[model samples]
Every structure is written in C-alpha cells, then in structure tokens.
Target: MTNKHSETSFFITAEEAADQLGVSRATLYAYVSRGLLRAHPTDSDSRRNCYARDDVVDLAGKRRRGRKPVDIAKSTLDWGMPVLESAITLIRDGQLYYRTNNAVALSERASLEDVACLLWDLPQADELEITPSVLPDGWHLLKAHYAKVPIIEALLPLFAIASEDGQTGIWQCDEARLASGAATLLGALFACITGCCPDRHPLHVQLATAWGQGPVGADLVRQALVLCADHELNASSFTARCVASTEASLRMAIIGGLAALSGGRHGGMTERIETAWQAIDPDNMTAHIRRQLAAGVEFPGFGHPLYPQGDARAKALLGSILPDFRFADEIVETMRALTGKAPSIDFALVAMRRYLGLPEGAAFCVFALGRSVGWIAHALEQRRQGQLIRPRAVYVGPDPGSSA
Candidate 1:
C-alpha cells in the first residue's frame, strides 16, 4: 500500500496537479501517460493518484518560458510577470515578506503601526507623528446623514474633503514632511473608519476600543492589520502608484486606491466571502459546497494564484483562530477537499470578524485600514521614481483609416 500524503507533501493530488499545470484533468493524465509527469498511487484510495509537485512545477516553468511575448504581457495583468519593481513586499516560495522581514513573523509580535514604519523605511513609529487630524467641516453632519452607508462608501467624500482642505503641496515635500503627512492621513483614515477620534493609543487599540473588543480581540485585529499592510502592487496599490506618479497628493493617491479596492474582486471580496459563508449550511457543508459548485457559484475566498500551495497569510491568521472556530475549520477543510484550494486572506478576515462577533462590514473596514499603509508606501516609492506611469496599448481595434 502507498502512503497517504498531506497538502504539504512532495506529491500533490490530481486537481492541484491540473491547476498548477493550467490544464484539464485529461491533459494532466496525458502528461502522466507521456512520462512528462510522475504519478503515485494514494494509500487512502488505490484508484486515485497524486503527481510529483516538482515535475508539475518544472513542466509549468518550461511552458511559461515558451509562451509568446504578447501572451506573457497579457498574462502579466493576471499574475503573469513583474510589471514594475519595488522593495516593499515580496511574495515568494509560498511565503510573504515585507522588505527583509517575514510578514507572518512580524504579525506575531508587531502592530500595524510597526509594519507601516517598516514598509515606509522609517526608524520608528514616532517618526510618523501619528496624531489625528482635525475633521473637515460638515464631516459629522455627513456621517450622521449617511449613517447607514457602507464605511468604504462614506469614506470617499470624507477623504475628498480632507484632501481639498489640507495642504496640496505633498509632491514638493521632503521625506520627513511626507512621513508626517502619511502618519496624519493614516490617523484620519482610522478616525473615519472607526467613527471616533483617535487618541495616543495604537491604531489597533483605537479600533478595538471603538468596536468594544477586549485585549484578545485587539491582538487579532493587530495581526490582521499587519498581514494586510501590503501585498506587492495589488490592483489598489498599482492604482495608488499611478496616481502618485502624476505628483498627486498622498491623500489623492490613497483616494484612487480606495476606489480600486472597492471593487468586488478586490478589497470588497471580504463582503462576498461573508455572504457566501452565510449561505453555507454548516451542518451539511460538503453537500452544500457541492451544490454550489454544481450551480457554477465561484467560491470567493478559496484560492490565490500567487500561492499555488496556499496563501501563507490566510494560513497564519486561520491557524490562530480556527482552533476556536470549529465551523470555520470545517469550511476550510471541506473547501480544500472539494476544490483542492485553500482559504485566502479574505476568508480569514471574514472568519475573524465572525469569530469576534463584529459588525457586518468590519472585515472590509479592517482591510481598507490596513491596506492604506501599503498605498502610502507605494505612493512614496512612485513619487521618488518620478516617472509617469503611462503604458502603450497593443491596438487590437480596427485601423482608423480602413473603410472595411
């Protein structure tokens, strides 16, 4: 009998093999038959086979190298290539690093403020001078009138007002002044999200106090914030860089990032995951998952292309909370068993919100708050490069002079 293999084993199951190869099961089997991949029988089920992960990765790398330049360029937008360079964050070999520090390791002991300082290349959080900004005129009135609005939506106008009311000379500022502005803007963002004035306490503590959470909940919030601080030029971060390249104020760059992140496929994914979780029948999770799959419902937070093995941030956060949240653990196991995918950070954030009994949109709020740190980092980096982020189109449309 063959030995059973876990997810971390050198051998991966058939579904993972196919996914890594970007091929169908039949194609994967064909590869095995043609001796391009090696398959081993599983001990739990003799009929099922697993492929050697090294073989799949090697074949995938060769296939990638053989692709056309245009194909590679198109794939770049979908996790294909490194479009630009940054020293802020690196996702490699299934681990996430912020600069030279491991993000997961930092999350264990550092606060979001600490990660911000690290990503911003500052010596200490004190350099940020993270004092809350005075609210814009009519800010309270706007909040009271739009009290039922989603926090992300409500924040847009608030940021606009703040941007307009404050100094618009960020593009000409030195690093010290820029850092001060970033710190103030971050404090203001926290105030907007939590609907309370921030004091001298750390941002996570302020958030926890606003939400009525205790010390344990505050620590969880800290971990989530630190983990979500940056992810190497995600959509929102890219948007931020583009705006900053135009010499826009840091607040404006952050505004662009917020707009990008509000999309359902980006930071808004937390809400989708929350909704999906609500639809799931915890008692009959596997059956419900199968039914959802049969109906062509895409599970929102199960997979990430960057980490073909698993999202380490998700794993770290989930590892911390899953032992206490039995249903969440079941969902993670059932989803992996059914789809050969693992929970993403989105899933972990939603699970954390549920476990903490926070309000409905708390997950997204946490994401936006934490990710603002990254936006600031990218903005500062782009400003230093001092180049406009303009890309040429491939001109797929019909020629303008052609009458056809």
Candidate 2:
C-alpha cells in the first residue's frame, strides 16, 4: 500500500515502512514488539497501523553498516552517531540547552554578551574586557568598496585584517588571553556589521541604534541574538572545532566557521527564505505555494529535523512578532496546513527583520554576530583537547593496484 499521508509527514504505513527497512511484515511486527519502532493505529481504519518513518530509517541505516571501523566512522558523519564530546550545548527532548541551562528561557532575559560569558565559562561579561579593536588602516575605503556586497562576504576580509593585527601566533596564548581575544573579536565584528564604533553599550543596543530602532526593537534583537548563540556540533561549530584541532589561532578557527556558515544549507538559509518570499506573489500566496509544491520546490524555512515537534526557537521568536505581520502569519498558517511542518528559526529571523523594517541582510548579520559566541566556545574547547581532527576516508574509487 502507498503512503496516503503527505510526503512531508513523519509517519508511514506498515508496508512502506517494511520496504524501507527491507524487512518482512513479521519482522516489522517483531521490531515494534521489541520497542525498536513505534506504531499507531490509523484514524480511518483501526486495524491498520502507521510506523514512525524516522525510527525505521535509523534502524535501516544501522543494519546496513558493516562491523568495520571505517564503516562505523563513515556512518557518524550524517547525524548517525556521536563523533565527539562537548560540554557547551546539548539538544535533547526537542529542547536546546547551554551547559544545562535552557536556551529558550535564557533568551527571555539574557543579552548576547551574557550568553557568550555562559558559553565561554566566564564568571561575567566584564571579565573579558570586551573593547572593540580599532578599525584597520584604510577601513573606510574597504567599507565603501564593499558597501553593496553581502554582509557575510564582506565580513571575511574584515575578519582577516582584524585577526592579523590583533592576534598573536597560533595557539600561544593562555586561556585568559584567548578569552580576551574572543571578546575583542566579537566587539570588532559588531562594530563592522553595524558601522558603529563599539562602546560599553550592549551589542544588541548598538545593533538597534545602527538600525534606528527604539527600546522595544532593541529587546527583540536581544532575544533573537541569545536564541541564535550556540547549537551543539552544527556544521559551522564543527568546522570551527576542526580548525582549532590543528592548534590554529582563534581567529583562524572563526574564519573557517564563517566560511562553513556561508553555505546555502547552514546559516545562509535565511537568504534562501528571503529570496523565496520575494519571488512569490504576496496577493496570491496560496496559489504560489501550490505551484511551487507542484514544481517539487521544498519550502525553505519550515521544519527542522532535530525538532520533530516544532522548532522552539521559532515558536518563541515568531510568537511575539507574527501578529504584527499579517502576510507572514498567513504564510506560516498556509505552509503548516500544506506540509504538516512549522517554521524554523531561519523563517523567524527573516520575519523579525521584516517586522522591524531593517535592511535586506539584517537576518544573516544577526545570525553571524550571535553565533560567533558559539564558534569561539568550540574553538577554545578543541584547543584544550589538543588532538588533530583528521578522520580516515573509506575509499570507493579506482583501485591503484588494478590501475583502473
């Protein structure tokens, strides 16, 4: 039997589930009996059952792996297993935590600086002495030349100059110096993004000032920054760790993280959501959605695999801002009805930008600024570990012996 549910659904019928697992009906039932998979009775027919597709896929993947070390290592790369340990963040039960504190709740009251201190294991933000580094010579010329470039791209050269001037040689600093450098880098980044000479004012307030926002807008920006601060072992964080594993400078690790985050599938997803919003007709949202669905286009900002229920960050941020933007509210409702998925944080960031009337790339700037904290945390942790992060590759190409 075919899966009658929408393709985006998390459940599948018994036949489809068994096919996915390459198992017989009897084995499928055995799996459910042993608690390897969960089954629910169908609404239309009580006799029929639907299985959790995620569980089935997980089991199938595990069964496909050989007992070789290379096979096991290869499997860990794609959400398969834990490849490394971390003490900074944990994602469990659809909730995100930073060092055992709930990240969502932290967002409610903490500034980005507070979260940075928490992640960096500092007693307080003041301990870091976070003063903005002076702008590199000719910064005005560089800024004017890159006025139209994407914010993420513009950050690379800016970071390179700041790193060269401010940082010592690779991995030579004590923890105190490293932490101080991290704070300085964060301040310099905020200065570059907001076009403001940073001061003792909170980074979020500086952002609000740069964007001409009042008190309420500043609070919203603060909340968004806290929520986006760190996620455990995400692509960019992992890349940061890999760079740090080589005993590179903290600036070098952050540069690697920025490069990874700029990919379309990572923090760059906000740009995709913005592009989709611009391409679709606002007056005919439903028809545009249906047409895009027919063309096999995946919705950019809905659903995160880690949060099977819904993205809590999105729920928290969007809950406050959705009522203000009717078009965004309608799009959220329509996409959920059509796809059985809720908005992810990327969507929430873009929606917040529109509500605040910020510039075109503000969403990404917020993400980069906030997530810089997490990247620094990872780099510091990896440096302490003092192990190179190289993993062996399982070669599947031509055999050198055969000269194929």
lDDT of 1 by residue, 1-404 (tens): 25555556688889998899887765565455334577788878876888778888998997778577666568556565456667788775678888868999999999887888888874344544567678777777876876798765777776666545447584237655666667878877776777676787888888898888999999999999999999987999999999999988888898999999988899889878878889988688889989999899967898987788899999999988999999999998888888999999999999999999998788988998899999999998898889999865556888899998
Point out where model 2 deviates above 4 Å.
Answer: 1-67, 123-129, 170-172
Which residue pairs in model 1 clash with each other? none
| Weakest ten-residue segment in model 1 by summed lDDT | 163-172
TM-score of 1: 0.81
In model 2, the Cα lDDT at residue 63 comes to 69
Candidate 2 lDDT over 1-404, as tens digits, reads 23455355788888999899876665565455334577777767866789877888898887676548787777567665446767788776678888879999999999998888889874334555457677778876777787899986887776676555644563246654556667878877776687666788888998999999999899999999999999888899999999999988777888898899888898899999999998879889989998899899977999987787899999999989998889999999989888889999999999999999998889988998899999988988888778899977888888888953
**Most TM-score-accurate candidate:** 2
Off by over 4 Å in 1: 1-72, 122-127, 170-172
lDDT of 1 at 271: 79
Question: How many residue pairs clash in model 2?
Answer: 0
> How far out, in Å, is residue 118 in model 1?
0.9
